[model samples]
Target: MKKLLLFVCTLCWLLPPAQAQTGTYKGIGTIVFEAGAPLSLIKGTSESANGLINLETGKFSFDVPITSFQFLNSLMQERFNDKYMKSSRYHKATFVGRIIDKGPVSAKGEAKVTAAGILTIHGVARKRTIEGTLVQKGNNWQLITAFPVELSDHHIQAPRLSSGYGASTMNVSLRMPLSPTDPDPQQIVAVKKFGFR
Candidate 1:
């Protein structure tokens, strides 16, 4: 009896935690920055953003490659990668946080949501809480949010020569249409159409 009980306890311990609901979506994400002063506003977009979510635990994560952002001007793109963002040094920016849902998040209607987590950019991590909207349409989930980012918050410094060029704060926004973890044929076709591999 004692041996059986020990074996059962060990088996239970090794089992994974209960995930009542889990889903994933592969889609594109974009970022646009509007400078305040003598600088030209820049808008960059990426079709390489990916997102993961756990509805049961209210956990979520997103990742975007630094090199994926494409600027309107080729020279600006080059400078952004080499000088400002330093893509070689810091390859990717990521956010890992949890959703703040007071009640169960509806899989059918739109819900106002907030997420609190650490955002890592240029190798600097800062705690941030962002508000957004979560909407479920058919078999898809869309997360949309827009917020301002301060350059000083992430230790991003502009060159002294161009000190007054770019804005001190940049407005950032994201919209991701996520599909199921195990996508069906229709979902796979949709993912391909979005230009994601």
Candidate 2:
């Protein structure tokens, strides 16, 4: 009985049971930065969307959560919700694109790819290019994107710098964990027709 109990305890310690990642998942991400400074201006991720990651073909389809934009502080959040972003009308900012560089992520340590496509924000679709880097350890993948998107590109009127802030492109950061999902664009968002714009 003591031996059995010891074995059970050892198993529990060895494996972090619930912390393991899942297949066919929904990930939440944040975009934190100012147009020219570091501020949590935009934050959003999909609670429900297709996440079929084709490491082989360097293709992907995803939906950016429409209702997840929160401001840096409570004050900013209120201001953004009420005035700047007007989250109620212009819900989500979505993107649909494919990785340009294809490689066998069959086994990986560090891999980099460039994803260029369209970003629709506040009812406007504009061209954008962002670099994606992934660090894979076992079945888990850590992804990161370092890129800049100009607010003017999407026609986000910058508040006067004298009273507001000085910035043109809003710096963006995206991190997500890949999961097992269907490889179909039917439920997947269309780069040309996604309604998140």
Candidate 3:
């Protein structure tokens, strides 16, 4: 009985840490419009979202409501709101994946990881397989992934363009730097406020 109890206690301690996902992933993620004149746009973000990070296991899940995506430029924001995203129908976008390597990242240090999960748009869920760079500054984990996201994959249609820039895929980029979830012993205060900062 003693041995069995001890084993149970050790296993519990060895298990991965519970999720501490509240980090600073919010940033001005770039939008590359390579279809035409290569227009580049920026979206605004802050340290606000539903994200969970498992420190022990190097796995994480991040989610953002479509309503949170904003652009500082009024005209651009309006255009995005009315056109491309169509946020009303799609309330949120979420990604759940594990880091291929056990990473406690450092500033200027780059590590590659295979983040295979699901991305949801407009209530449609699709598989996501993308590689990303994990940047760590202090305890904050900053993740950036750039990949081709096809609109057609989710029955999504690109907004009608007055100009001829029908690039089949959108070069999507993500800057998710998370700290700790919130109000817990596991809560680690994030350094830079990527989104609001």
Candidate 4:
């Protein structure tokens, strides 16, 4: 009986904590943005946004290829990539951060959450606090967030009248459906390098 009890205690001590047993989720999602112009809103979207979230630690990372964004007007898309965003020089925009709120998310309904992270755009990184909602359905989770980006903050020049483009700010929205899975090794390394662990 003494030996059995000792074995059980040892086994329990070797096991990981419940909080450390949470799964990581990774998936590709849709990202959309809108900018105000003189006559109409410039709307664009991309289905190539990739994201990873570790529920146990609340660490998350998201990235989207700048050239993947599509616009209603091909010329506008070209201008956005070449002249405005300079996608050739800065191929992608990324965000890495962790959730700051406490309490476990209830599976029954939407839960409001806030995340503070670094948002990198146009080769510049800025710290931002974003608020969003999380909803659980079956074995997957859905996260949605909307935030505004100022042109000046990232050193992106405002559109010029002669260029027939004018947008001072861009409203960005992200909708991601994340499912539990083993994360890519490279992605894990990148996330750790960003200090999210």
Candidate 5:
């Protein structure tokens, strides 16, 4: 029995590493916003966005801390967090969705995909479908999407203190970079069998 166990252990060690599996992957990125009237451009960006994606299931989720958003004017930033966004009550904005890729996403190419999911902001959740491009360069994946979000839909009240800040729709852009999470046994098996990164 001991000899048999030794043989099995040796066989396992001799096997190649398993292929990459499709599972939960952690990533960090940014969410940017450009709003105000057509003539007026109000832009702010936040680098505290983090996300996760499952390659096999196409499931994805993203979150951005509201306080991370930065503006050129510190006063505007303060008001945006305390007065307009009310970040004290709602700390983060999040999106949970899946990528609709027509075919398998290549590990080294680019694909145009649409993500449909529920987005929650200011304590309000709404259904949203956003189209974006996914590019895989080396071991990293980048996702970029731009869409218009209506403040009224999320029940975000416009501040009367500044007309420059009020807008019917806010143009939002997302740029996220993701790395693979720890692979499972099955993924390891695949990696060993097929040598997938």
Candidate 6:
């Protein structure tokens, strides 16, 4: 019995640690932003947002390809990518941070949460504390948040259109459904390539 107990203890010690509960958002996630334009609202959207959250540690990271955003008018889109965002140089915007109110999220109700992290856009990184709602849906969690981003904060200049001037601030919203699973290897590689942990 002593020998058996010793063997069991050694086995447990040598075994690898259990993987943390992680949720990955891919493909289906959406990010929308609207800014006040000269005559109307400048709205854009992207469905290529990707990210992952580790529930156990409250660590999370999200990436958005700058060129993926689409505008209604082709000319507007070109100007946005070329002049405003400089998508050719920046390529992507990313956020890496932790959820402050860490706890088990229940499926029955929504929990208000705050994420404190660094948001990188147009090659500028800024610390931000964003508030959002988290709700469990079946085996997944949905994150919804809306925040205002000042163009000047990231060194982004508001477009000087012929009609007038664009808004200095834009409203950005995100709706992401995260599946409880390990992130794909390719996604991990991509994140690493972009210097995100």
- On lDDT, the candidate that comes out on top is 4
What would the per-residue lDDT of candidate 5 be over residues 119-187, giving only the tens digit for each residue? 999999999888887677666678788999898998887543345555667789988887767667554
Per-candidate TM-score against the hidden true structure: 0.72, 0.64, 0.60, 0.77, 0.79, 0.77
Which residue pairs clash within candidate 4?
Answer: none
What lDDT is obtained when candidate 1 is compared to the true structure?
Answer: 0.69
Per-candidate count of clashing residue pairs (backbone under 3 Å) = 0, 1, 11, 0, 7, 0
Q: How close is candidate 2 to the true structure, as a TM-score?
A: 0.64
Model 6, span 106-188: residue lDDT tens: 45646677899999999999999999887766546688889999999899989765567767898999999877675443322
Cα displacement (angstroms), candidate 6, residue 87, comes to 0.4
Instruction: Please report how far candidate 4 places residue 102 from its true position, in Å.
Output: 4.6
By lDDT, the candidates rank as 4, 6, 5, 1, 3, 2
Stretches > 4 Å off in candidate 5: 1-18, 37-39, 103-108, 159-165, 186-197
lDDT of each: 0.69, 0.56, 0.56, 0.79, 0.75, 0.76
lDDT per residue, candidate 3, 61-90, as tens digits? 777766665556677566555666677777
Could you give candidate 1's per-residue lDDT for residues 1-197 as a string of tens digits?
A: 99999998788556442211134444555555545544556567777777886554567888899899887879878987898889999999898998764333554567677899989988999999999887767656687889887878877865332444545676778888866665332322332222111
- At residue 120, give the lDDT of candidate 3: 78
RMSD of each: 9.8, 11.4, 8.4, 6.4, 4.3, 7.3
lDDT of 6 at 2: 100
Lowest-lDDT window of 10 residues in candidate 1?
Answer: 188-197
TM-score computed on alpha carbons, candidate 4: 0.77
- TM-score-sorted candidate list, best first: 5, 4, 6, 1, 2, 3
The true-structure Cα RMSD of candidate 1 reads 9.8
Question: Cα miss at 156, model 6 (Å)?
Answer: 0.6
